[model samples]
Every structure is written in C-alpha cells, then in structure tokens.
Target: MNTLPQWAELLVSFFIILGASFTFIGSLGLLRLPDFMARLHAPTKATTLGVGGIIIGSMLYFSLSDTLSLHELLIAIFLFLTAPISAHLLAKAGLHLELKLTDNTRDLRKKPEQYSDKDS
Candidate 1:
C-alpha cells in the first residue's frame, strides 16, 4: 500500500476529528433541545456537515492511493442534496400534526394581519 505524506496524513486526521466533533455536538443538541422543531436544525445541518467532512477525508486518503474513489463523493453529494429536503419534510409533518413549540419560539406561520397596527 502506498503511504500518505505527513501533510496529507495530518489533513485527513484533522477532517476526521472535526467531523466527529460536529456529529457529537449535533447528537447532543438533538437530545437536549426543547422541542422537535427546535432540534431539527442541529442534526440536519451540523450532522450533515459532519458526515461530509469525514467523506472528504476518506476521499482524500483513497484518491491519493493507486485509484480514485467515487463512492465518498457520491455519498457527500447525496447527503448535501437530501438533508434539507428531508428536514423540511419532517418539519412540515410536525407542523401539520400541530407539534407544540417551546414558549420561546415564535410561530411565524401566524397570519400577517396579526402584526398590523390596526389591531390596537
């Protein structure tokens, strides 16, 4: 097997570590957030980026060897494309089901007239 140079090795290690850290933080947010809508942002955004980072590291490591690796790139592309759509679907479903929000979260779905000065 061909060996990676010191710089490449360091870069790969950095990506892996960064990815793991983000995944961990995202998972923690999922568990600790007050409600479903509040929690969705953490995993969908942070965790997706986390996996992307690890995929990038894997791609770098493999591409530097005897052959190019397309699997990681495909996975990263699929993930980037799907995460937002899936999160939106999930949030839409939650809203349709009338999922309750924490008191601190304002419901933007309210009718615009509710904000009018005429109400006073």
Candidate 2:
C-alpha cells in the first residue's frame, strides 16, 4: 500500500549518481595530483563531500520507504567528525617526516636554534 511519486525516486537516484561521481573524482585526484599536500586536499575535500551526499541520499530514500528517520544520520555525523581529523593527522605526519616534493610551496622543518634548551 505504498504510493510514492516518480519524481522522488528520480531525485534519489540523481543524488546517488552525483555522490558516486564525486567519489570517483576524488580518487582520480589522489592518483593524479603531483605533490603530497596537493594530493592530500583531493581526498579530504571531495571524498568527504561525496560521502556526505551519499549519506543524504540514503537518508532520503530510507525515510521515504520506511517512514522512519533511522540511523543514516549517525553515519553522516561520524564521517563528518572523523574525516577532517584523519586528514589533519596525515598532513601533520607528512610534515613531521619532512617529505619533500618537486613543487613544494612551503618549508617543512623548523630552523635550528628556534627551540630553546637551557641544558644546551
């Protein structure tokens, strides 16, 4: 006894396709970008948006079918919270390791004597 509009189904499908495209673009950027920081931006930005879009599509589809808000919200929330932290940690670690690139725009390591140690 379900009566759903065709437009709603179409919209949901559109969102799913959009999300998949974003994710694919992100993966391509990760592979094709030249440098570490540049490459870091690809997945962090695009993939996050892509996953968010997919989660939203899931929420809409489930809500329409089940008439319950459900736990898709939690997945979106967790992804938003964690993805940025993971990206930040990755960038920081890369800087700590002093990984260099041909087109590096910023210096990674601190200059010597910038740190003060009385024992020294």
Candidate 3:
C-alpha cells in the first residue's frame, strides 16, 4: 500500500480549494455583473478555468493510484473546446437580434456601410 507524500496531498488540496474559489467567484460574477455581455464573460472564462483546474487535480490524484484514468482529461478537453464556441455563437445571435442593454459600453456589431461608386 502506497501513501501520498504530505507535499503531494497539500498540493492536491490547494488545487481543489483554488478551483472551488474560482467557481464561486464565477457564480458571483454571474449574479453581480450589470450587463449581459459582461456577465457572459465572467462565467465563461472563470468557470472554464475552474473546471479545468479541478479536472487536472482529479487526473493527478488518480494517476498516482496505479490504474490509469483519462476521463478527466477528456472532459477537460471537451469543455475547453466547446465553451468558447458556445459563448461566441450566443453573442453573435444576440447581436444579430439587436438586443439592447440599459448600459452598453460599446456597440461591437455595428453594421458596415456599403459604399457606392456614384458617390463622387
């Protein structure tokens, strides 16, 4: 029977705490941010990192146990790949629908004007 070194255990605990804190912060941001775009960024970025960290910690903890486990890595990879795409599509759809916010900082999806040659 092999026991994890004290240092390894401490490291794992630290990662778990860090990941939990980030996820909490993301949830708070989701509630606190005033606007939709700003709110969208908070959860998408922080939660992604938080989940990634937890998954890595789980991978480390399991890898040290002799039996190989790739489930955590696969989940993390899928999450990293999909989260951004989902956010982008949602933002694009919002812009297309001309959703207006009470306090919009800047209009990112301003339509480009078509120039005509007859305009001198």
Candidate 4:
C-alpha cells in the first residue's frame, strides 16, 4: 500500500472534486433544460470533461505511486474520441426526426441540405 505525497494527494483530490462538480452540473442541465438539443449539449460537453478530469486524477494518483496506468489513459482517450461522435450522431438523429427545438434553442440553418446527408 503506497501512500501518495502531500502534493500528489492534493492534485488528485482537486481533479476528483472538479470532475464531480462538472458531472453534477451537467446532470442538472440535462434534467432541467427543455428540449433535446439543449439537453444534448449538457451531457456531451460537461460530462465528458468531468469524466476526463476524474480519469486524469486517477492516472496521476496511480502514476505517482506505481507505474503509469494504461487503464486510465485508455479510458480518457476513448472517452474524448467517442464523445463528439456520439453527440453528432444524436444530433443527426434529432434532425432526421425533425424534433421540436425550444424557442430559446438557437435556430439551426434555414436549409437542411447544407448539413444533411440525404442524397438529391
């Protein structure tokens, strides 16, 4: 059982707390915000960042005491790589369905062809 030094422990704690805060805020946004588009922004952006921070903190904690962890690095990498792709897919589905957007939700382009993948 290795004990982390004060500085390393502090850094790890900071990252964990920051991650938790962002995750909580993102969850709140998802629940409270009206409409799918607004809801999509919350989890994709904030939750990804939150989880990344937590992963980084885990990496730091383990790396400080042991060899650098492949698990944490891989998780962070996969998360960052997938989040945007998932968000894009969800948005495309929403557009395909022509889901209603709240008035506060900024209007998408007037023309769908510009962004849509449909063939002429």
The prediction achieving the highest TM-score against the true structure is 1
lDDT digits (tens) for residues 1-111 of candidate 3: 567788877777788878888888999999998777777887899988888888877877777755767989889989999999999988888777786665554664453
* Candidate number achieving the greatest lDDT relative to the actual structure: 4
Model 1 lDDT-worst window of ten: 111-120
lDDT of 4 at 2: 96
lDDT measured at residue 106 in model 1 versus the true structure, 0 to 100? 75
**TM-score for model 1?**
0.89
**Which portions of model 4 show Cα errors greater than 4 Å?**
109-120
Task: Estimate the TM-score of every prediction.
Answer: 0.89, 0.82, 0.83, 0.88
lDDT string for model 4 (1-120, tens) is 799899999999999999999999999999999999899999999999899889989989888999877698888888899999999999999988989988888766677687788888
TM-score ranking of the models:
1, 4, 3, 2
lDDT of 2 by residue, 1-120 (tens): 565589878888888888888999999999998888789988989998888788878888878877877598888888889988999999999888887765555553455555545455
When summed lDDT is taken over every stretch of 10 residues in candidate 2, the lowest stretch is 107-116
Q: lDDT of all predictions, in order shown?
A: 0.90, 0.83, 0.80, 0.91
Q: In model 3, where is the ten-residue run with the lowest total lDDT?
A: 108-117
Whole-model lDDT for model 2 versus the true structure? 0.83
Clashing pairs in 3: none
| lDDT by residue (tens digit), candidate 1, 37-114 | 989999998899799889988998998875888899888888999999999999999989989898887787677577
TM-score of 2: 0.82
Instruction: List residue ranges in candidate 1 displaced over 4 A.
Output: 112-120
Quote the RMSD, in angstroms, for model 4.
Answer: 3.0
